[model samples]
Target: MHVAVLGAGYAGLSTARRLESRLPPEVDLTVVNDGPDHVLVHEVHRAVRRPAVADAITIPLSDVLDRATVVDARVESVDAEAGRADLDAGETLSWEYGALCLGSETAYYGIDGLSERATPLKSLSDAAAIRERFLALCDAGGGQVVVGGAGLSGVQVAGELTALAEERGLAVPDDIEVVLVEQLEEVAPNFPANFRRAVREELTDRGVDVRTGTTVERVTDGGVETDAGPLAYDQLVWTGGITGDDATGGDRPTVRADLRLTDRTFALGDAARAVDADGEPVPASASAAIRMGKTAAENVGRLVDHELNGSADEFDPRLERYRFDVPGWLVSVGDGAVAQIGPTVLRGTAARASKTTVGAGYLTSVGAVHNAVNLAEEELL
Candidate 1:
């Protein structure tokens, strides 16, 4: 039996690793990704301040997978009904079972000149470019640095930029004005009220000019055009929103708790808008993606067993359903961090430690033990 897994992000990598032990030795497992390495995307923001940390967050596929064939190519489209996936390299892969976890891309939201003007913090390259631009601005005697979108990514990058400026001997707000703008009423808008308040406090203490309820209408060469007024900036970084992968025509298709796109195909992670078994909307986060991947892997295993046994049963095998249950949330602001667990919200040293632990834990879970050690040393020490 041939099983193909698309994309090597958090979801795809987790599914592939679990499948190795679940499937039979004779089953051919292939993983297709645009890159050869799986990136700890949530930690990519750290690279914006410390470029050397990039290696600790990116793990090569060869180091983790024992039996899967890794195909490094972009997935152009997935025809689930046909059980075929077309690659950008002009090749097609046919599979008996498939898992689609292509992740997402930055959404410019049809804002004028935004796509061309703003640097997004979604990848290693994006982090590097943002660092370069910020450093150049500092060299030019400092100016306003505007960050569009006050989501987790935006808030993290804004904090990193402030730290970067201070490291370059620039005064916060005075020399380098770090402005964080959000259309919502508060930063980390989707999170709990207490967590949002803590994040805003940390950013404010770090000299970030927090602008809530400010909608960005357009982007111009000089600065950002917003509902409030024109906010001038020497550089702009956007972390506003994300859309589905291009393979799915930039739409996050709905998926049930089982994470199945078709009888023989599964879709999870940011590529699909998923609802849990209890009918709760699953938020697009690294933790959520990993959980969905695990659940999907088990369901895939059940299906494989049923087919191999040649079961004449009229109904398909009972598949495992995914539930959206996460322990907490964490976000870093400059040197400090914020963590929300249940009804409690924490900040300062405890929160910072929690944030570091989560990053290292994810690395270790992915079989990147060496990388995990390096990440811990870099983050904690």
Candidate 2:
């Protein structure tokens, strides 16, 4: 009666926590990942400009998973049919059921020099690397900076860099520029038009060059070579794309409504191409991931209970569908932000406060009260 949850990002942590509360006490639960702490994936961009905030946002897996075994190792591969997983340290885990929440890796869009030249903003290490590079650029008296992908991540990074430059004031180059490149016609395509416009306005107001409908042909050491023209920059940040793990790979079968890839296994978050009733792909947001994780965990509990009861095949428990109706999204630029919930879009300090409120609520949900308070203080103050 062992349940193994892989890769403890938002989806993994959420699933593991909910499963612990629902499953029988005797059911052994194991949560495995490369890091022992669950870092806030979404806030890593902010952490770049504010490094001290990382500690408060990251929660130790050991402290949170009192009912589960915590394994700190890279998961090399998982055999769903065999109910086994291979780890990087030459170890194996056998489980009766498995949930894949390995998340995703940055995608370079087949552009030349992008991977080598651009610094991605995804993990804690990535954020630290961005901070280091920015520091170097500042020390060198500042220079032009180009960021590819005007999605929320790109927008946030560009905004943060702009804020950082403003803090530096005249210490950096007066001619310094920050450009955001997006192939799409608008930023945050998934968001409503008003919200997108609001975010764009914020970027423009902060002196960010938002070039939409411009494709990056390739990245060069000196700058980004876009279809429109070549632009020189001292730093280039790529927040373009991501790809998921195997069972949720582009080459494999799509995830079912129950969030299952196989009868004994499930996939959630960026690891799966989860769709709604109309088969529309779900946005890869933290909110969606949390909801998907909860649904998947509930289904697993139902299956485990049925198995333990030795119920007949026809008497199987019902599985709930993954329902991710994310009310809205928020994008921050310095002390201000643009948030949308339902049909309403808001801006200014209120929006900024909304973002902090969401972060605090998430920390509370994950049983990190102290961390929540600290994050609230760091963000609000």
lDDT against the true structure, each candidate: 0.92, 0.85
* Pairs of residues at least 3 apart in sequence or in different chains that clash in candidate 2: none
Q: TM-score each candidate.
A: 0.98, 0.95
Cα RMSD for candidate 2? 1.9
Candidate 1, after superposition: displacement of residue 240 in Å?
Answer: 0.9
Off by over 4 Å in 2: 171-174, 245-253
Q: Candidate 1: what lDDT?
A: 0.92
lDDT of 2 by residue, 136-177 (tens): 887777888888988878999888887887776633236567
Lowest-scoring 10 consecutive residues by lDDT in candidate 2? 244-253
How many angstroms is residue 249 displaced in model 1 relative to the true structure, after the best TM-score fit?
1.2
lDDT of 1 by residue, 229-269 (tens): 99998899989999988998998889999999998799999
TM-score of structure candidate 2: 0.95
